[model samples]
Target: MIVKHGSTTFLKVIIFLTGIAVLALCVWLPEIAIRDARVHPDTAFFLIPFLLCAYGFCIAFSVALYQAYKLLTYIEKNNAFSELSLKSLKIIKKCAFTVIFLILLGIVSLRVLAKVTGGDDAAGPISLCLMGILATSIITAIVDALQKPLKNILELKPEND
Candidate 1:
């Protein structure tokens, strides 16, 4: 029990640090966008939608991190197999999907902007967006895989109890 709590504590700390890092990134992004807008005034319009998408991604990431923290807490409390933990997992899965959707939306918007601005250097951003989508998809898949077993366990738990 002590070991389990300690492990969950460590995971919670990691989640906290991750949240802080993402918050810092969210703060730093606006400055970067402002700088980019000043440097390439023509692409200033592009920056707005991109920044919006970035902010949406950050929000979804934060939500997923919070859900993860909740899941860890559930584990520490010996409620790892409970409905609360399952709910947290579901929320995390939804957050991952939301992130993937946001990334796809950003990619599409980027492509449209590039065509409008005659900007041919969109490969880097598009590639990054694709990677984000892939990573989020993996997370979503993992959560989905976990969900089925969790559901089965929950269904059988009442009978055992």
Candidate 2:
């Protein structure tokens, strides 16, 4: 029980740090993108829309991280199986799916830009977007899987009460 408690605390700290890092990245990415665009004028046309999409996804990711923090709090309070936890998981799943969808859209945009520009520079960001989609899809699936058992527990709890 003590070890479990310690691990939860550690995880919460890690999550907190991760949330901060995500925020920092969200702020930093636009500046970097702008600088790169200035250095490479040819890509500036697509960079504007990419930065906009990136900012939108950043907001979604931040919300998902906040939900994870709330879920962690529920676990620490011995309410991991409660409706609140389930709701958090549901929100997190939606956020992950939103991210996946946004990345897929970005992939299509990059493809179009590459064809129009007749350049291979978009390949790098396209690969990154594909990986992002895959990662977010997995996160969404895991959260969905968690929701099932949590839903069962939440349903049974009232009868037991």
Q: How close to the true structure is residue 44 of candidate 1, measured as C-alpha lDDT?
A: 89
User: In candidate 1, what residue range of length 10 has the lowest lDDT sum?
Assistant: 1-10
TM-score of each: 0.91, 0.89
**Model 1 stretches with alpha carbons more than 4 Å out:** 1-3
- As a whole number from 0 to 100, the lDDT of residue 13 in candidate 2 is 89
Candidate 2 clashes between residue pairs 3 or more apart in a chain or in different chains: none
Q: Candidate 1 at residue 105, lDDT?
A: 92
Weakest ten-residue segment in model 2 by summed lDDT: 1-10
Q: Write the per-residue lDDT of candidate 1 for residues 62-126, one digit (tens) a residue.
A: 99999999988877877788899899999999889889888999989978977988846789999
What is each predicted model's overall lDDT from 0 to 1?
0.89, 0.85
lDDT of 1: 0.89
The C-alpha RMSD in Å for every predicted model, in order, reads 1.7, 2.0
lDDT value, residue 5 of candidate 2: 71
Residue-pair clashes per prediction, in order, are 0, 0
